[model samples]
Target: MEFQQTGELEEDVWFDDVDPMLLEPSNNLKQRKLSVALVDEEGTDGLTKHVAVDCEMVGVGYKGQESILARVSIVNEFGKCVYDKYVKPREKVTDYRTDVSGIKAHHIQSEAVLRKLLALAMRDIQGQMPISRTFQYLKKEIYFSMTFKEFKDAYEPCKKQVEGIFLLGPLMDKVTDFRRWEEFQDVQREVADIFKDRIIVGHALSNDLKVLFLGHPRRKVRDTSDYKPFRRLNKGSKPSLKKLAQVILNKTIQAGQHDSIEDACVAMKLYMLNRKEWERSNKSKGVLKQTKYFCTNDSKSIKDEKRRKIKIFKIRNLQKKRR
Candidate 1:
């Protein structure tokens, strides 16, 4: 993971000769390939505990103004993808933002596809069942009645149909690697668990954490965007990851569409390049506490804190009136 300090940075040396297709998305679905890689479980045993993460969002809600997580990527200290999955948004996606997010309709399971699969499964479970009952079963209530055997039987035919659809052309190649979350909350919980005990490195990580509705202790976060040295590189303002990669790494990124894996790798590389100095600086500032905790307060704790502050404010007012 270490790069040699040279007068001029070479693209291959900086990027480890990454495939261009991994950074840029192809308009043709057939040409696009999922760049997921398996993490070496043993490799992490003696490696740095820092893991970099990045998220790509699709537009949800009215007029595509709200952003929701569509894809998330996490890279280990060695810059290998440990986790990467496309998320099905709770709200309907109004825009895929293909130009920026690189997420297309095929990247996630669509409502039509879900309904089709459900219909096929229901038909198998309830032979000659009324259309009304079939539709009712599709409404999330059917899972209660169906046993694992029955569900698997129902899914068998649907699986074949899905395979056939894939063989039909571009869809087969494009969707073969499609990984989606049935419930958005499941992804949130899983991501929170993955980050619970590790140092997270990223750029503009606050935005990702906000969307995930999770928090990590400040001491465990290494945000390149918020780093003082990186800020200075951008003339004291918060620098973009793209800019940092271009200037610091001497490589181009985000030229067309944003790739979470690429972004995660860039952030991790930046952290690795300055790992020693970064840790020392944080230690000197007394912010490098070795505690495995998230910055989440329970509802009761929050209410208690609020009441305590209010009571203190009232006491101060009473004292001023007495004076």
Candidate 2:
């Protein structure tokens, strides 16, 4: 369920620096090890903590040729939302990708742009309220001071009144100059800190890290896409998160638009399902390495022995014919 930062979890697998699998047949490995190498530079070095991460990207290239991070979400082991933020790109954005991303123009627009339009509307609505009422009384009014029960009761039924105010100009032309935004930088820094030296679990993680421009020690990444035991589910190919969740988790995900939090949680769940098996099987990597080495040498020796036998048989036949 949890791992210590240093050699503790590894010690369980490594068995005090001796691979227990050395006792097993060298050729009995189920498959090669499916772990990243232990050479990551920015590795986290405390108690080993794992966080599931998912990122949403929108195109930002020629004809929307490139993908840029528009949103990112991280969830803890207990499936709590730890970090979520919308990332604005540095270049002028080409598409908002409402279909999959659900990001709209207004969501990225600055307070300066939105506040001016909102202030006028707020002023008009403020006039509708009793001007003579004190601020204290206004706070307790029906729209402002509703109880939790009252709010939930009216939420769905009031959609008609709410729908109109939510609509904006089909959305203005996509806003530009996203890279300069301070919020995006702050988010990038926060994500880096959270992931620093911590094991990060995700599907197709390299793409997420690339888009985020963040570095994690490779050893700290437990990518579900490359996980070996799950390979058979997709016929030896790396599985998409959607497929892995459906098959391994017996639940559907990404049926509609992609949700980062949902994907992150699903990846975490899949890993948890096979954690013990995976760690146990990982110990066999040493055996696999040893097996391959011996197998290669054995194959060469067998070929040479057969060649010697064939040559000797031909020599004896020649002598018999001469006799």
Candidate 3:
């Protein structure tokens, strides 16, 4: 079906039957708020380095046996819990997903609150820092704004300088959000318009592109999911983020449920780990020249006594012999 998306949708409209726990715990509403002076740390600018988003859906069986998304959760790259919201489905909640999602019909009577919470969470994660060029969606589209060399340099951007938006699903296709295909289209346009030819670093990123409908060129995408380090020691279809995090970072992740912020950080760690190996393999330096020569093939070796040598004593002699 051809889906038409409009950008004029209200930012404040709420969904009915959304769960409250999906909204992240706000620091402002806490009983005890820790007070610490904002001090400038050395060699570090206070800015978000990455954004990770994961969706927890109330999957309901429909039309015999089909699953559908009912809710979602999002987190920042700093491993900070940011956005969580339960969406109210248009249809009745089936008996199957109640145990898994913990979201019943009673939980999401108010959609307005959930919508406000999500908008705030997105703003909170966005903060005041400007978006990096690495988040660019298309290179040619951005060329008029910035030079190709300038955009190319952004491919391997510094963590402190770029905001990496990490997603849990495949990269090639956009997820159906808010029970409205329009919402997905709007998000895609927004992302593309904001970030044009910049780098997108993630795991199994080919799938991510499939999910996002983004066409990331080779050398522009840093896919940790495809890279295999310690190949002789480990051989498989690339390790899971949870396993890699436990082994490399010495931390536990994807515990209880999956978090996108943690996933993004894990992807970055995997990329960094494999980057050293890539460098080692590509290490070649110093000046060099090229030369080519043809060798004659002989089936059998000639006896030394019967061997003879033909030599041109001078360049003129060689030219005369050729002539």
Best by TM-score: 1
For model 2, residues 85-192, the per-residue Cα lDDT tens digits are 777565556776767875654445454555344333434454465433423332232113444444334333422323335222222122233233336678888888
Off by over 4 Å in 1: 1-48, 111-182, 290-323
**For model 2, what is the error of residue 298's alpha carbon versus the real structure, in angstroms, after optimal superposition?**
42
What does the lDDT come to for candidate 2?
A: 0.59
- Report, for every candidate in turn, its global Cα lDDT versus the true structure: 0.68, 0.59, 0.39
**In terms of TM-score, how similar is model 1 to the real structure?**
0.59
| Top-lDDT structure, candidate number | 1
lDDT of 3 by residue, 1-323 (tens): 14467887746645365333223232221111332111213423222333333333443333313233344333233334444444455333344244444444334433343334323433444434434532342321111244445433432232232243322122112212223222445544544443244444465554433333445335344555544342211233455666655555556766664544456556654444455554453243111121211111121111211231122135447898899
TM-score (C-alpha) between model 2 and the true structure: 0.54
Give the residue spans of candidate 3 off by over 4 A.
1-182, 193-195, 230-234, 279-323
